[model samples]
Target: MLRRGNEGKKPLKEKIILHYDILFKSHGDDSFDTPTFWEEFFLLKAHPDYIEKKFESFVAKDLIQMKDRLNFLFEKCLEYIQCDQPVRVINALQTMSCLFRGIHSVEVGDHGFDKINLLVGFDMAETSMQVLLRCLTAGLTNDHYNTTIKAVILQLLLVIATGTDNISQNTFVEYLMTNEELYDTLLELLTDPVARSRLGNDTVLLLALMVNYRKYEGVNPFVMRLSVLDDELALSCLGSVISSAFASFNKQFVSKQEESKSSGLFSTITNMVGSMFIGDSDEQKQMIKSNEAILLALYEAIHLNRNFISVLTHSHTDATLVGTPPHTPGGTDDESVPSQPATPTPESFVDASTTRNVLSTFLQYTSVVMQDTKLKRNISSTKLCFIILTCITEDQFANSFIHDENMSFQVCIHKMPMRHRKVKAIVEKPGAPLACWLLDLTVEFIVSHMMKDLPFSQHMRCLGIIHRLMCHEKKCQIRLSYNWRELWTALINLIKFILSNESAIFGRWKKGIFALFTLVINIFNMFITFGDTFLPTPTSYDELYYEIIRLHQVFHSLENFVLRHNANPEYKDVSSRLASSMVNVLAIVRHFNPKIEQYMKDNNMASLTEEEVLEIVKSNYDDLTLKLQHSLDHFERYSERPKETHFFTELVRSISEQYRKTMVFDNIDLQDFMHF
Candidate 1:
């Protein structure tokens, strides 16, 4: 019995010491003849039966004896990797990666992996990183050993990155930061096609861990270096880095099933991208100052990936109508010809659904950036906003984005105030400021696009966005003082064009008319509520009066159109609502008119009668009259359609009752006007 127990214990104890000696006793000068020995040893260590039975006991007993062995092994592996024998080098790397994985898998309860502190405490983490960096550089430069060696190198790098203690992670980060060549080499490798395909996500995670370590340690060497790079190189580097990160995020997190691993991967990528702009120093601010192209590239990458996610999640089908000729009024299908199946064209990345998602994602990212107070003050941030303005204002994106009421255009509008505060602070600077430019661009887009020929829904959307801007207190305050004249002129022209076009007034464009009315009301309310800021100078009173007169004529034309259409059941509610809007317009004009007349009287033109005033405004008054007459004539042809003549009876009676109560209209019969 004693001899059997000794025999059984002898081999187990010998095997443990043999593994420890191979790991620790190896040195850089050792011969490469033992490559198979190390490979076989790692293969034995990876076996399930050995792990389940002997691995824990072996580690608990031999881990202390193997003190600093990982460091020596890392050095020996590096030496072998640099040797001329390809087989020895590959085997050395595979053995190194498997050993690291095995060490990382040994867990002690609540203490994390047991052997990670060996590398970190001995200050060997940097050496491991150097080896991994060398492998990455090699994989990138030599295409012959790309896939096999590169993948194993990445696995080793990730094991060190994610499976180590925080001190070890920081030590690795320090190596990456202090070696600029290594940093740039890693980025170059990331952009390389072969390296990216084999090791993109792992590289991204490593980069993220470095950034996060810097954050925790409060030493931002990488970001500091990024700040001082030449503009072109900096932009190129950022573009490549962010594009690769976005690709990884799309593949692992957005396109795949949402597992915990993928979620962690996405979080790391996000942290990496965000770390670039997170610092508060002037250098960090300068990193984003003039790099509009870089920021735009990042934004577009996220936008594209977001679109990919939407496509993957949504169910999309395409139906094509092919090989079918138009039929005559009484034609039937021919019996002799066989019909062919309509083949559906494959959906592409730029399909309508994807395009819509691209727009949505663009807006969402724009909103996020705008709301980030850290970035809000950066010039590049403003430029990013300018890019978004340019996109949404363009005919293609705008026309498509606005027609979908389900879109978040309104949500973006609501977030403009955050941007408004930032832009307001810098509005008066010498160069073209973003806030002023965006406001001017918005006006230009509205005037150029919201025409009579456009669809009513499109027009309504354009007007709705404008209404939101007009109602935004900050935008109104700034715009009312800076670009109010240009904005007012463009809006007046739009209103005149809409009122003059009979189709706009009476066709299926009631929503558009209502939107236009709401925009005008908001503008007028801004002028009224902010009287101290918006009041015209005494010298400008005549121009203001002329504007009020033009508005009065517009309101009168609108009132007449509503009265004519009030008898049509289709237009009954719309006409009534518009009539009420007209009453509000009249009241606004009435309140401002007396004040303007008093100014005119106090200035010089007290003797001008109503006829004189009409003569002075003859050109605009004639224009208004001609438009109203044309609309009335157009409606006269449609007058024979079924009408509820009593639609306006209550409306007219209310007006007469108010007039009788306020004024001495002697011998007036309200019933006469109520009959319509």
Candidate 2:
């Protein structure tokens, strides 16, 4: 029994030290069967003050002895796990986890540098790897273990798999991948009906990490085995996880009008499942094809939760009554009034009320679902949305689901609210403001998918979604009504973010630049077409001026980047086309706002002569050429064999090819537009 209150406080530190000393002294020879001593030691070690202040020094003084003792304890723990003694097993696992956590903390120098030299000399990685493999093997082969024990084992494995030391992590991955039995066991556990409800999300997450590891380290034999795993089996496994996640989410949050924080579990499962299909390997393609059930599950889950159609059609009856035909024009009021109720006509089917409801519900659902799944707030939601978007855009079968007359995409759009009041309360209410969700979702999609350096075709598919949304007149009008400047700022900042991060635009800078240019042009066109109707007030005019200045700066930044890279023959044509596009846009800007033209002149942009621009371009070209030649000389002198051309060289070649096929000059020809 522990002492209480002030009596315990005075001697607490002394008591902890005494406990530690006795445990070490008793187990000094690396042999101990005293459970009481071990339990006392575990409790003392787990105290926050002891762990934070004294654990490292205690372990450091006799490092060899401590390691050997830990090794013995770990072996004992494994034995305990196999004996079906739940209490002992849990305590043992917890003790081992804590020890490993301490060891990792010390090894990584996370505890500070007072004992780095002593900690570094120990081979903790080798011991950790051995223990990790043994635990994994035991967990796999043991059938008597219940879900609680299995969850503990899985959690321990996660800790070991994500070890701080690279050597141990690599060794663990190698072991897991090389052992076919282990792989099969993990798959079985993931799909097991009883275990999946409790551990499916975590299991899929581990597999995702495994997949990522394999991708990063280059081809592995394990990946081939995974690919060849029966496609139907893989799909069924993934579908089970997704279904369980959705069921859990629905159970918790289905009745609430506002979303609950607990929905993260469902998001996690969907994200993991989606991540499993991110690559374009034939195996992945086949797995995706077989997993249509997952998509259907998500659709049904969303449909049941939101009931978009009912929400959309709720006000339809009221709308139809108000839209009744007016009394005959020339008749007196008494005579004009119909004897019977106004008869329905073909025109009534397309009444203002129906159109309003449809559009409202559509916008509402789109915003709400997007907010729910945005990557910034939830990776699972992001992945789920990506999967849904990809399927709708790329797969015919999934496309048909959305476009089916019975489940019309238009109906989905119509379910959303048209007025800001309805949308403002629900969309992103807990996170960002409602007005920013769409922009946030767009940026999240790009960053999550594109920044991974996936194929250009995949990037194009993502961009296509944004393009479709921006081009829709109704969507644009709705967005403008609900704080358009906020949306506009988000887009501008997104472009700037891409420009600043080389990885985001890697190997596809031309297309990225072209996309930004097109976005700016589109925004300008919106302003030109809608003008004060969208602007609404004087504050909007001020915001518009600021936006124009930002656009001018972005244009200059792109031009400079192009000029700096134009020395290469591959970039010359793209550079020229981009420059031409910039010029065309500038001409339109001058027409759209005379005040902006004067601002440009004050900033010396108006005074930038063609000769000066050429001079800047030529200087950049000379500097880049010199640098390239010097790099080539150094490589030739130092390298024994010829070095293959750099990836950037291939990137440039690809961009050149893409530019020729997709580049459009003077595409935005706003030359004919009269000034607003």
List model 2 lDDT by residue over 34-121, tens digit each: 7765544433323323432334565444554554555555555555554444445554555455454455445433432222223222
What is the C-alpha local distance difference test score of candidate 2?
A: 0.41
Which consecutive 10 residues in model 1 have the weakest lDDT in total? 626-635
TM-score of 2: 0.44
Q: What lDDT does the true structure give each of the candidates? A: 0.42, 0.41
Off by over 4 Å in 2: 1-65, 108-143, 165-173, 231-234, 243-462, 466-513, 518-676
Indicate the TM-score of model 1.
0.36
Off by over 4 Å in 1: 1-36, 39-62, 68-76, 84-91, 98-117, 120-136, 164-170, 197-201, 216-218, 231-676
CA lDDT of 443 in candidate 1?
55
